[model samples]
Target: MMSFNATLRLAACLSGALFVNAACADQLDDIKKAGKIRIAVAMGTPLFSYLDEKLQPIGSDVETAALLAKDLGVQFEMVSVTNAARIPTLQANKADIVVADLSITPEREKVIDFSRPYAALTIIVAAPKGTVVKDYADLNGKKVGLTRATVNDTMTTQLAKGAEIQRYEDDATLITSVVTGQVDAFSSTPSNLGEVMKRAPQKNWERKFDQKDFLLGIALNKEQPRLKAWINTWVEAKLKDGTLGAIYKKYHGRDLPANVVQL
Candidate 1:
């Protein structure tokens, strides 16, 4: 029963909406046109992202993000985020990509897409040498500090039965808890535990056990397939050329695993 004019008007409105959606979906083209790429980096995570003596961000992730922008011929813009904020920042479209040490997990894949892994990390439980924490069973009744929403937290929460789990917002705070003796033990990457050990060597902090070896992938919104594909290809190229391995070794003092680079 609609008149010709009314039908035409409805059609025109729908057409405009579709055009807008298409434009919004083309993030790859948008990034190229804008000449800038915003990457989310989580600060306070040592050897990944952290502040230097000059209060400037420096780490493997920071350098990797810069390398990505340079390779793309775009200006690099870092969007500082906490581990808990990385996915939310990408989901909100505040960043073009997340270059933080984001572990690839099934729960995360349901919400966002991940490029092939460009790095890897080992999750671990650490306590003073006197603590005698040989395994998860040893954590019973102990207070374990962890950075909230990280792979370390996930593994510890699922495995460290009967232990009181304390979550911190970021790595620095978790390290602080360990140094202040607020936490009897903590879960984090080996590098992060090393940072703690340096701050309190008198306590003889040492890794108790390894929990999991997680691959780090670049995260982006699920809608940006083009961007994701480009990232995957870039990661492969970087891996083959040894650029990523060099960066990892520069901070971590070891080469990337053969299996990881071959992947």
Candidate 2:
């Protein structure tokens, strides 16, 4: 009943649709078929992801990533990245997912999908006890250091208006800057400041003020609906089983917050 040219056109349309569907196939299946999962980790971030004495990667994120791969029955590949490279590495397909300490923010959500809160971080302004930085106003004209592209950087940039903000590429560099007197103060987590204190106990570094507490999540490309859903379910299971809490306590010396575990 159909004319020859019309039949050809219909066939072409169907073929095009099939090609598009194949091109947009679920990434999770691809990962499974590949027999490995590449996870992006921002190393040098103590308590999150960092190198061990043997120069092997070991930390909360590293362990979490390994667990994910184990659950998936795949090999684990660690893609080391700097703080600023976490999202970009995922976008570039250099990593399948990011287990780095990625904070959930509206701006970041626009570009990547995130699992439910699996952990939390509290940002604070830390300075030598003698520095007298009790509030944002106190940072005026003082040099403040923070790792670039972190929540600390965002909070300090937004609130510490008059402070001279110095950005470091990584946590180690920021800590070194503080130790060498390159910064008057720095924005970081309490655990990070504790590391700095260990290096310079006489300075008696203390938190000047709490900036904000953020919910950290695992990140992946926005298009992977199946992977995102799976990660969410996995996170919930880990939280309920106390697996995540144990990992947090092992490194952070404290249990995960009730709100984070209850999420």
Candidate 3:
């Protein structure tokens, strides 16, 4: 009993509803169809993703993401961004996910979403071999150099505000400052500081700290709830399967401490 005009209006309404459904899309499906899971990782050595002798990328984060892509049924693609640009990169849709060592902070929570953290990396103090900075007590008034964008600055300053805190642009510079006697010690996460120690111009230079701080998380935009859920679920599965611990040991050369908690 509908007239021609009524039929046309009904068809248009149905098409509009379809368009609305399409607009509120599922990014996971899009990624799978593209056949690759892209990642935004901070550039560095031995800690996150890094370049190897063969000029191929290799590291804990890199290998872990590749495995995650395999589990997700897609190829892995990595893009480098800095700490400052990390959130912006995700917000701008420059990367599908962020696997860098993103510390979960309440301030950051307002704009970005984070996956359940699978790893904990807090800052500690590094001293050259034979330097007696074995604990917080030994750092009363020493000079400490810390890399920016890490938990180091606050940790160092809080433990001993009497001590001088100098922030650097990168890990290499902070380590160099400690090595060259420009600073009494350096501070950064275990992975970064450990990597610097491993490649120190001399052997046996290392850090000492009694307490750890925060766990790192995979940051995403507020809209990517599905991606956040996927990473959290995937990380939990890896931990249960022992693949998570195995991969960390393979790169870090030790087991994760039992006391270290994941979120």
Candidate 4:
């Protein structure tokens, strides 16, 4: 027979293996038990997730997350996060899902799983009027501002290879940079630029080029495959019933392009 100590050590190793396997295994069960779904969202991006005059979280992502929790029969808990923090929040177990305008990409997929895309994003290059910036090639040697570490930044770096790409921490700073001429122009989503114009109304700024359209999805922990599958089904239902576009139009002031509406 095995010695008492050896048997105890073997049992401990087996238990440790089981514990490792069980980590993040009960994601759905834990959320249901807690009666709330915590969603991490960008707090400064207008039309996506931002504070209203009342300082309440109010935007498309906020509304979408609320509806998601409602369908799941749970309370909606909003956790403000930044562009760089979206995936990390989910990884740290601080948020159950991320609705922070996270674009699905091959690189990010290696870190976290994504729900079927629930929305689409169009990135644009905008410059001051009379700037003569007609296209990405025109950005070369010009100072262009964009949110650091965003897809916009990534694309700008690729397209404007010779440009002086200035990175800011958030949208507010990026808008300020363009308005103050801190940079020659800024790269951002049209919705964000529209919101900035509503507040700043710098008519001198105009879009120079349409960068690309990307699919946006909710980010979740890779360990939660069941939760990911459930969210994908939920997103499909929302898209079919026009719920997603309705919310998008309510915040964005335009209908979601039909081409970018489906999975």
| Residue pairs with backbone atoms closer than 3 Å in model 4 (clashes) | none
Q: State each candidate's clash count.
A: 0, 0, 0, 0
TM-score each candidate: 0.90, 0.90, 0.77, 0.87
Across 169-220, the per-residue lDDT of candidate 3 in tens digits comes to 5565665666566887777767766666666657566757645667777776
Q: Write the per-residue lDDT of candidate 1 for residues 18-75, one digit (tens) a residue.
A: 5444443457889999999999999999999999999999999999999999999999
Q: What overall lDDT, based on C-alpha atoms, would model 3 receive against the true structure?
A: 0.70
- For 1-263, candidate 4 gives per-residue lDDT tens digits of 23364344445444675544444345877899899999998878878887888989898999999999999999999998878778878899999999988888888888887888888889999876788887888888889899987899898898889899999877767776776668887899997677656666756677778988888989887656457657988988898899999999899888777665643
Location of the lowest summed lDDT over 10 successive residues in candidate 1: 1-10
- Candidate 3 weakest ten by summed lDDT: 1-10
Q: On a 0 to 1 TM-score scale, where does candidate 4 land against the true structure? A: 0.87
lDDT at 169, model 4: 76
Best by lDDT: 1
Q: Between candidates 1 and 2, name the one with more favorable lDDT.
A: 1
lDDT of 2 by residue, 30-149 (tens): 898999999999999988888889998988889999998999899999999999999999999999999999999999998887899999989999998888888999999999999999
Let me know the TM-score candidate 1 reaches against the reference structure.
0.90
Ranking by TM-score: 2, 1, 4, 3
- Rate residue 62 of model 2 by lDDT: 90
Better of 3 and 4 by TM-score: 4
Where model 1 places Cα greater than 4 Å from the true spot, the runs are 1-25
